[model samples]
Target chain A: MRKLSKVITIFVMVFLSVALSFAQGSGDKLGDQSKLIKTLNKPLTFVFIPKVIHPWYDVVKEGALAAAEEFKKMGITVNIKFDAPTNADISEQMKKIEANISARPDGLAIAALDPATNTRLINDAIKAKLNVITFDTDAPNSNRPLYVGHSKDFQDGYDLGEYLAKLINYKGKVGILSGSLTAPNHVGRVKGFKEAIAKYPGISIVFDRPDNDDLQKAVELTENALQANSDLVGIFGCNASNPIGAARAVKAAGKTGKVHIVGMDDLPETLQLIKEGVIDATKAQRQWEIGYWAVKYLVAMNQNHTIPAVHETGSRLITKNDL
Target chain B: MKKFIKTKEMSMFIALAILCLIMTVSTSTFMTPYNIGIIARQISFIAIVAIGQTIVLLTGGIDLSVGSIAGLSGILCSLLMTKMHVDTLSIIFISLVLGIILGCVNGILIGRLKLNAFIVTLAMGEIYGGLILVITRGYPILDLPESFAFLGQGMIGLVPVPVIFMLVITVVIAYILENTPFGRNIYAVGGNSVAAKLAGIKVENVTLYVYMLSGMFASFSGLLLTSRMNAGQPTIGSSWVMPSVTAAIIGGTSLSGGEGTIIGTIIGAAFMGVLANGIVLLNISSYWERVITGAVVIIAVVIDLLRKIRSQKE
Candidate 1:
């Protein structure tokens, strides 16, 4: 019984330690460089809140956190609070926004899960006299001071179309493993994909499977699509997970030579898959740039400085050859 | 009540038969051996978990943590094999054991403390999910050996290992549910917990064992999935919860507890798998799959409800 008690106690302690450890992050002494950033016109605090605690946000978080320290000497205090909800809940995010507002930060850097769900909260934050800048997923028309992420969703989408068109030499039946049709970003990319493919007379979108932004579902859906259409020319994943799914499914189905695939985002898995000749190419979204620009935009907004109203972090087309 | 209860379980079988007839006429590929293999492999994970879950449901409990436990164990196994330099088989075995431990935890709180199983498993699910993120730092372990990969990708005489796992688990669970005294105890406990206590059933032990079994099944899927991907991502099994629950319910397992079957759940999973396979074979969009799945789940339940009503009227 004593041994049981001892073991239980150890388990609890270990579990707590692991949970608490994540909350710490790399909070290292940014104070060392705080003075160099003291040139700010006023004391400002910018907060970057993510939709979830997934590894995808790690780069963006580092950007905002580092920028906070960089601009701290200029009387800027970047308060990075990212205790995102359990499953990327939009309602929980709104509550967090309220809490951030309660903290009365000067500027906010947030990547919205659903623009429609969070628009009112962001608008309310704007009315509360806080500066808002979107990163990754944007909430446009929310009266944010500026947008500071990817320049054009079209470029990302077009890259896949262009790469695949060139691969099949623009002459075959290609399919699209599209993402959530309702998501504006996904919708915009598909539009761009269609526009790009239209330039190639022979390349037609015979099959477009909008996969609701799930990888395994994409795989299953893509697998069946491939089986149904063995004579298909190529495939384009309209989202990050979509491409990875397409690639994996294509590989699993042993259709590597039959279909050329590409998609957007540089998810590590996607990158490795590209290296493995699964994905033909992926349009890289520089996460560090999104973070860097979000902080830069927030810092500028807090100081009442007018920079370019629109900022694009720029994108790179990555292919197997590049890898 | 007994007649109504029996019909709810068989409704999906009817649905499956109807879908097969329609699919055979509509798509030539639907009846192929390869497609059948794909269909079996596709539903194996859900089938495996649902079989175990049906047992738990028979004892008047629910386990919301199965998906989380699968994901957690998958990442844990990969991390053990890759980062900690543990032997691959040992890592897989330990991960499965951890899943059982998680289930046991759920059983202890729900059975011994007499807390609501729904609330306890839900909270435990969240806790298990958090541990997954914390342990992996949100990155997949990419370097699983070729043998592990082969386990996920390889097949024995055209049958995927996962499907075999599903079939084996189903048979074992069927034996336990039908041939064992514990099986009898399950229906008794779920039929009426108060009576079960008076009739000398070890209620807590049964409850605990059922959940542990659920975890073990989930762990099997997790290991298979990690091997298939040759990596372990934190989000590996997020889409599994609904399918697992739907399979159990559609298989004629009563959510209210006291009656269910392992074979029935397996068939239900295969039925759902065929539907998903049909959708893909026909080239339906992936996003629509969700809407369709939700609709199918609702229709299955409604049909089950109707079957019960008809039997009751009889």
Candidate 2:
């Protein structure tokens, strides 16, 4: 019994140390930088909220905590509190923002899911004297001082469209799989893709299916697109799941090499597909930079520094060779 | 034949026909063999799960955990294959067994313990979601074997394998609900549990089996999806709970219990599938798809109610 108690005590000690390390790992310190700025004389608390709890936002949270560490180094005890809804929900985001407002943090950074529905709440956050800044899907019309995110969604789609057209030799029909139409970024990408397709008159969009960000629906849409358009040469997916879904359908039909696929976002499956030659290419967004810079900008603003109205974190074209 | 005409399934059939006619007129591609194949394949997953849900509903119980069960089972199957080197067939078998065990958890709570079905399943769904997150950490499992894809993406002659699975499950369920003594017991249990108990029927067993069956079907559907995507996705089946209930409800399955047909549910699934296809084919703004679908479901239910009232008056 004494030996068992000693073993239990050792186990509890090891468990506590492991848990403590995990807690500290989340509070990443900012890496070496070329420029130096004054640290805050007093401790300031900041809240960072994302649209949802996802792997993508996990990177964003890393950037925010890193920024907090940077502030801490400057003699400011920057307390960073990160909170978000369990799912990608707009109303839940609003409630979190409201609670943050009640807490009266020194500043707040948010990535809005529904900009229109959130515009009033954002304005209210500003009305409450909280330094509110938007990242990722921005609330442009809101009273927020700066919007730090990717370049125009249209340009991203246009580039993919042009690349795909050239790959197909400006011929045959192509299908476009998109996310929810209500999403501004997805709509912009579709418009840009259309504009690019218009330049290649030989290539026509046979069908466009909205999967509502559901991967299963994305698979079904791709199958239907292939079935409905027998002459299809390629597909362009506007979201992470769209390309993976399209690739599955293409592979299932034994048309992998023949049917080229281009998609947005560098999801793990998308990267795997690219490595396997199932997906021709994907446009990799600087999601890490979006988060990293958003927090940096928020910190500067908190310190009475003026920032740009729009910060464009550019995208990269990733192919098989790049992988 | 005359009695068949008066049935709710006939009215739903007429609605589906009218919807198809409108789609055909609006889009030249709507009636193509390819498009029909897509609709059938797309309806298979929801339809299969709904068949299980319909069984539970016939016993006056709701299974909100169907979607979560699918997600959890798929993730677990994917993990076993990727980490443990489990063979394809055995992985699927183990996943289905896991689903049955999970369902039995609910069965024990709702059936044996006599807890509220809604609350029990809702809480269980949360537990399932948490377990999936713990296992997957929000990342997809991509090392699916080649042989596994056949179950989801393969075709026999002209029909997709998933569609075949859907049809087989539907036929078996329809037989069980219509011809078997256990089928009558289900109706009896749902219609009146006290009377069913008085009539020498094992009410608790029927309840437990239906929930178990719901879990099994959900797990099977998840495996099909894992095959289709060629990966095990953490987010698989997140949008399924509503559609499972919707398909059964639209198929003329009474939520209050004791009235529904698998054929009606199949037609209902087809109706929804076609409506979505029509929106895409006609080039209507995709934003209107959800609005239109919601309106159609309401209109379909209202028309059915009106038909019942008219028949009573006659």
Candidate 3:
């Protein structure tokens, strides 16, 4: 009986070792990998990555979540994954991208930080025959097959510029506050915004303050810009967080009523400011559609549904009327 | 000639001039008072933190917790003002002292306990960041007193209050770094711990004070930010870590310890702020701003390297 017990212990150890090695081998085989063949015999799975897990993405999350629920009954098992590089570093994001590809999901929806940075990853993902699309941010040069967000970042900027221009009745020495000047999306918007403002004739972006996505810097920049451009009659914040910082500075300077203010995103402060008439209106993009289409295409491609190369998500001009 | 020619200070000064020139030419609006004021005021936050970072960097160490500390304290002070019904005047004082305490803990762990400065501060940053989020749940504390807000937004005549704060801070810190006995001891400890210990300077105390000072500066930036926004936000200090390092590095300060200047860091901070502002003012797309920024950072480092090479040759 003792000899039999010893034999059982040795057998259990051998089984555990074999299982561990098998698990290890599988993990290394597909680390964040998206491969269509992996789902050929199983339920289809897809992962959607945003710029970061911001409250703004909550809307996108809802849209994707809803779609996943609908597709579950169709025998397509979709898994939603998320990651945020503490900062925008291409190499840092590449690690997550590599892991996603290695995991060998059926599809991937990405919002890359920069086109230049993701060039190599785009090459690898395409070579491996994985389905990919962009939402919110796009890698235009990369062969990602489809871009599901705004057709172009410049259009989004144009939309913002048009909204502010018409609201101010196309006349004012206006200042622009932005988060980062280097972001392709923001850059596109700036170009479009500048062109759109030219149509206004009287409206000019007197001072352009780039806060590097830092809210504190945003406030300081706005305050200085206001001081330097005392002739400024309006302010248009170019990103989600800039409006509050700009508005706060404007309010502090006792110029709330004297200057027209317009900004982006519906942060509680921006919403409050709009409600209180501190800011005229805000411009919101269809983040819900971005996430929805990104995930939908990812899942469909897994099921062998070949879709279009680019899916343009339009921006919504959210004035007090819409809110 | 060699000693004077290849100085880190000279290298950083040159980089600052080049960046100024590039931006000045690229954007017609870049050199205006409005833009200059924005850059100078904007740099104050990072410059303050960099002063502390410089101290840590001088000791051949780093502090990742400064950003978290700023966020955490910003939330705390804002909450106190808005929720606890505490007086804003008292709240600012509490935040400043809290900064010192936080820095002291970092100093103790690294200086006294002999822990790895990077790991200790990194973990502390996480712990503090989580604590801030856990307490506030990722929202800004609003409805701060105007008097409190005034400290951040109020200008004393033509100068921004924050820039004034920066100037005052740099002057005092510079004085200590160059003159005070305690300051001299700090240099000794940073230069060589064993040698300093043998020379009878209390190395542990000096190290402790430097980190504590770093925390205080971060807290000051947080308080100023709080006033600037008239709210306390948990996410306010998210990207501060890099700029603090960037300012210190570009200012001719070595990451390996033993040399630096508060003024140089202030200039570096201003340089970063100006570069970003110039790109936007030139009507460049916001997205391309990052490309320009990344390019500027690389250039600053390269310029520093060339200066080092030149100094070596001289």
Candidate 4:
């Protein structure tokens, strides 16, 4: 009986090790796909669709326009058509995507609003022989060639959380002002923050609220949160507006340096706050990089060059010192 | 005393007191001096805007363009200050004048041309909102002068400067609504426009003035908010329109016309502020806050309706 049990334990250990190795191998394969070299000297047009006409997407446009300029310098005409819906409505986004698909651009980049609907639209575009890639917000289930943007929103939040935990000495009450509860990116950030803070046993989250991406609403919510938890030591602003809002509230309550603020995005107001020492830090997503790479990768894919499945334009943690 | 107790403003006051009582019981921080100050400063902006909304409601018209006017005025003022090197006082004056001009355009269309108030203002709102986007291109104008911050972030003996402005504006507007012949004309015009016209009130002029006042109030709030934020944000007044209307309605201002007070509107604004503050103090889920706020607005309106029906029967 002892000999049989030993054989079974050895077999089980071997199976588990093999499975782990296979998982790692697959991860590497997805991340490190070798680029297939191709050169195509021709004029091309690409359509880029974002979720909404926001300032954030404006930065993305800048990056894309820069890439187009770069191609122009190389004597290749890369016409980038940047179209976006005025509102973040799923149906409107779908309509825009359908219109673009029918137009049949050489390459298409989309920030998916609704994953299921967008996946179907992306598949239709694929059927039309248009090379499609996702940016900013991805429709992973679709037949898109690649995703190029800040893919790790969770990591952005987790890193900020860890930085904030360290700032507060890993102990005290904290508050999270998540922008838009329904947004997948905001939700992922909030989850990451909660998970990161949970690792520190002494840290407790006393307040969690959604500001709906409104600056004034964020200010009101943060003020209320500060009032509710007088002993609160830190705040995590899960979007651009929230950190500036939190900084204002902390300044108003005369708790400026007493409460640490770690937030996402480096809007001008946010950077100003950081410079003034009102905000501790912020994680600015590489928006320009997302736009730059989406254009480059789309051009490459159109030329039949193989690129990595995901291109994560990482974020930068901006502190007062960094400014 | 009996007559006071029967007033809509009085009822709103009582409701507000009960809400405060509940909040105080539920949380130690609700009644704190610090929280009160915060609530006061926060409510002052909407309350000021609601004052004009109350007047517009009294005149049987709505100004959906107030929010857009606010946003545009703020952007214009910030541009003047930062780009053109305009002085602080001149910046304020210019923005307010610009607001009046915007309001005048709406008035000329709705009052003189006799267009539908809802459609005219809604379209005007879209135009103004679009202009804000076009002007700023989704960027916030920053680096406002330091001296200008006092209007928003300053305090006098623990009362925020904005609160003082709110109270002063409330008193003046309340007096105008309750005492003067112009005030009587507003009530008369709102009660019955044909009757008011026969009674020798220039209905168009009154309409024009009310909208102008609404625009001025909105611009004032925009200025204060920009000062507070230390930047001119394009998204500043996008959320103000619904709340301005909600505050007036909650204060027992009749939507049809001729039935609300500035004091009542103030109380309505305060009620909203307290409810929002209390939600956080009570640690309620953020998702439930909107649900509660909507229910409260409905309840307040229903109470007003029930009172009207009871009085009619009596």
**Index of the highest-lDDT prediction:** 4
User: Could you give candidate 2's per-residue lDDT for residues A68-180 as a string of tens digits?
Assistant: 67766776676665666555644335445655565566778888776654666688789978899888878788899988888589998999999999999998999889776
Query: How many angstroms is the interface RMSD of candidate 1?
Result: 19.2
**How well does model 1 score by local distance difference test?**
0.75
Residue ranges of candidate 2 with Cα displaced over 4 Å: A1-323
Score each candidate by Cα lDDT.
0.75, 0.81, 0.74, 0.84
Q: Write the per-residue lDDT of candidate 1 for residues A35-87, one digit (tens) a residue.
A: 34435545565666676555667777777777777877665566554544334
* Of candidates 4 and 3, the better by lDDT: 4
TM-score for predicted model 2 compared with the true structure? 0.53
Worst 10 residues of 1 chain A by lDDT: A83-92
lDDT of 3 by residue, B171-220 (tens): 99899888999878877777788898999988778888888988998988
| Model 2 chain B weakest lDDT span, ten residues long | B279-288
Question: Which scores higher on DockQ, 2 or 3?
Answer: 3
Candidate 3 has an lDDT of: 0.74
Counting clashing residue pairs in each candidate, in order, gives: 9, 0, 32, 0
Model 1: per-residue Cα lDDT at residue A95: 39
DockQ of each: 0.02, 0.02, 0.03, 0.01
Q: Which lDDT value does model 4 have at A248?
A: 95
- Tell me the lDDT of candidate 4: 0.84
Native contacts conserved, per model? 0.00, 0.00, 0.02, 0.00
